[model samples]
Target: MSSSPATRRMSASQRIIVDITDWNRFLFAGKPISGVHRITLGLLRAWKKLGLPFEIIRHDPETNRHKIISHRFIEEDFSEPIHIGGGRIEYSYNKYVQRRTRYFTELAKAKLRRFVKKKEVVHEDFIEGNYEPQADDLLYFCGAGWDAPETMHAAHKWKAQHPGFRFVVLVHDFIPLINKVYRNRLGTRQFRRWFRDAARSADEFICISDNTQADFMLHWRRCGGQGVPRCRVVTNPHEFLSVSDTRNQPMSNGELSAETFLANRNRRYLLTVGTLSSHKNLERLLSAWNTLNFFRDPEADLVIVGDNDPRDVRSLSPIRRNVFLFQKPPDDILKLLYMNAFCSIFPSLYEGWGLPVGESLWFGKVCLCSKSSSIPEVGQDMCPYFDPYSTEEILLALTNALFEKDYIPSYEKRIDRGRMKSWATYGSEIHTALLKMT
Candidate 1:
């Protein structure tokens, strides 16, 4: 069978005009800081390394339009000294009021965190501008569009203006729609709006997983929508332990950094990386850990490495002992944790792509993950699985693997067979496919 255009690669001589129009978070933070932010930076950096010609653009709040940004803008905001607090920013009269409002929201969040540290907080500091979509340019949303309605609405408007203009969106997941409990009422409603708008606006979608694409299609049908776009299942690329990644790479001495050593205290640990949110099903994992009789491995600790605190797990009866919660540790420390871990555990109930699973596979480590959502799609036959819902099943899987003398070697062999495409390859492939679309 012939490959679809979405999957087909462009010739070497072919070039696509890709306009990345969704830098909503960066525009707010003035830097790529969080995981969501890092995904955009990593992929863009990879594309630049591949010498793919692309432009960065943002929606104009004033006029609600699209426009190409100046290269100087990139240098100023991304590369050089910024306008505010050593950060680059676009200043506008309207945006000034908006940013000031958000500044106070941050203070409010700080106050609220004292009592409810787990609350998901967002305070944006962004600028406004106007732009028009060029003919033959392929628009790419760099992140979730719901956070910036201007960007989402602008895409729809531009599509209406230029009916032949092609655009692609990255579907991280339909987590909110799939599990309503994952998000609050406001977040759920906003994401639903983005989904409906994005489904209508884009010519194609790059799904992070087959499960994600399926979920999107199912939601599309449920919304009484017709004619699904060309959705390609391209999982996120994994960058393995870089011997040269000094920024976040473990030390060559194979010893944890002094600070990390002091923090964790050289204990046998099972690492779980990602936001410590309710969606990750941390509560069940904690419950299982509590029931497992820590006396069997007194030195063993479950280290939750993430930004958001797992508030749901705090309420578990007879909470798991020796639970170490590390909030937003440095990348080098995270690498050290992963490298020294007895085993990595990811008990997320839902995921668009289980990145921690991919990370474990990348590192040739044994990962015991929930056999739910897109996790199995990533793990396949390699990583061990347990039903995240039943605490007993999780405990059963963990006990079998932990007590087994030869399980690590057996699973490491399985990881060797499970290969993933690198970011460099993903960047090159996406460039080719998108050029073809253009």
Candidate 2:
């Protein structure tokens, strides 16, 4: 599913119209970007770098209109590097400033366009012109659309208005449906509605992993979806590994760098990145860690990152002093922790596509993750796997990863960085798939 530069571009008349409605919402929410958001941003950058003819649009819920976002505006405002490092106050201040800047920038552009009445658009969020999809145009939604029901409604409307144009939805995972008990009740309901609507509206499906594709097909069929749309699997890439380069940045006042923090502790650490959600299997991981008696080991420490909810910390408070949890660490700090870790553990019971597994492999670290779902597809032979549900298996893997002298180095030697999937290849595969359907 690879494509050369020449084959990646569509014809002059046809274009890939990416729906960034959710992307805008993510930015506006001022919350830490999730894996889905990162994927959306990465794909946009990849497509832009490939010189593909594309336009970005956001659905306006108030008016039920799709606003064409200026490519220049996106490039200038968002395409900058993302590094949300610092303490709580600094992070909040930065996010607030960013939001206000973007808000004013878009508002000013809109006002300036009205005053000048120029034909050439500079930077407008809501463009004056209406966009009618051409027969060959591909309308793609590559972001998390379940959060925005308006996007799904727009997709349905677009499919009805322009029957000839192709509409596609990128399926990240069916976790919300599969692991409903582990998710928010209202969110899961919305996910079902979104998936059903997408299945009915889309002419093609782009799944992030093989397992996700199978789940999507199974659910689609069970839901009594209409005529089958061509489905394809275009796996997520490991470009995030490159974000570990934070050597040149100045250290924040009174804050120790991740490297210094680790050095000060003077201990080896096993790292895990994810929320405290039950599906992540953190409770199981903690059980194994405690059973192993590493909680009392001064030479070893278990550092948990990405659990922002304070209520979830109550369960973990029982752990001994050696266990550490850094809630919502910055990307740079997280990458640094990965770089200096003894190993990484992902005890997720299920996953759509395991980002932590891919990330660990990218860093050439020993990753002990679950055997279930799409994780193995990312880890392959570079890491050891075990049943996430089995504490014994997890403990065994942990013991081997920690005690076995050559266990990690052996796997690390096999890490072929060059063979790893990249965002460019990901974009090319999606483009090729769309071309095939056309």
Candidate 3:
């Protein structure tokens, strides 16, 4: 029997079109890319592995044109996009600048050469006006596809001219549409307009979580979107392990002191891993953590590991001496943190899918997960659920996690199941869906 529904092998005859506009934007603005970027990249790599006939395309933001450009993704294991660092290189200390000088110089030369060779075609990737999309062609917008609405608008006209041109969109979440407080006024308004247009234009839909699909259909009907395409709920494939699997390794990283290290030896740390934002409800966790009677559970510390908003940290009720924020930990350190942590906590009030909750289970650690949105779908019975809105609820969960040795009653099944959710499986599911369109 096949391990997954997506396990069927794909043939090379499949002529699928993919939107890759977001990839270039991510490259230039490279400051720790989002999960969307990672998912898109993983999907592309998976499709290529299947050797299914496909065209990689993107719409030119400047020219409003589109074309298939497959050559851009030949390299793999992309090195960290050179960080320019916080301070300007010109005024920086010599030692610091010298360390990254080679990267900066190469980047400068590359940009200079592009500028020097400027042509009428600022972008060479634009689709020629004469190049019309073929009938029976499938356009898959797997990313947010910021220009999806615009493409759908133009696609309607193109479909009238040509035939059998269909577009499939992947809706990650309805956070912006459903919750105004989640985003700023301008961003929320922009997303609403864009989503409304996308809803009207897209021929079909796929949602990462059930919450997203239900909300999308609700909005589509509410907004009276056209030709409401069939929506599929294909859960995301999570290969959360680093290429270098560091399981079973000792956690003796020298970042912590002898005192903190000794303290951590008794019960290990409580972890929360994800980019901190307003929606994550970390402030409440911090508030609850502060109020916890450390006299009873003094050994445990709360270790937050991810890129986070400084403002959120600053606004924390009171910075606990035991609570440490480890911003942007590398893959190795992160593995250790996950492996050795006593239990993971996710107080996120909203998410397309709570990756940390699954990751915690994947590492065989207990999770104090929220009962909000699609989080429960990821956690199931594997994690201890808590109301993210209530500090008391969070505090109680924390206490249980710290005091109760058997907080996660049974999670062995979850750990085993999470391993089958691979990117190959994800790619296979996506290909199967594409074939259905044909």
Q: Tens digits of per-residue lDDT for model 1 on 1-438?
A: 111223555444333443444453445445434454456656666666666676666643222334445444332223212331123433222221244587467545545544564542221222223444655556777576666555656667767787666768888887777554385665666677677777777788888788888888788866545685687876776554221122443222124332455465655667887664668877777778877764466357777776544453455635445665665455556676777778898988888888788777777678998998889987887888888888899888778767777876688777753267577776766666576566
Candidate 2 TM-score, C-alpha based: 0.81
lDDT by residue for model 2 (72-152), tens: 533433323322211111111111123458746755655565467545322233353445667677888888876655566
The C-alpha lDDT values of all candidates are: 0.62, 0.70, 0.65
Q: Per-residue CA lDDT of candidate 3, range 117-167, in tens?
A: 573233333233322477767778887655244455565676676567777
- List the candidate 1 regions with Cα displacement exceeding 4 Å: 1-23, 26-32, 60-132, 180-183, 240-258, 262-266, 310-321
Best first by TM-score, ranked: 2, 3, 1
Superposed Cα deviation of residue 130, candidate 1 (Å): 6.9
Candidate 3, position 7, lDDT? 36
Candidate 3, TM-score vs. the true structure? 0.77
In model 3, the runs with Cα more than 4 Å from the true position are: 1-14, 62-64, 71-79, 82-132, 147-157, 180-183, 241-267, 293-298, 409-414, 418-420
The number of the candidate with the highest TM-score is: 2
Clashes of each: 7, 0, 0
Clashes of 3: 0
Q: What TM-score, over all chains together, does every model reach?
A: 0.76, 0.81, 0.77
- How far does residue 61 in candidate 2 sit from its true spot (Å)? 3.3
RMSD of each: 8.7, 7.5, 8.8
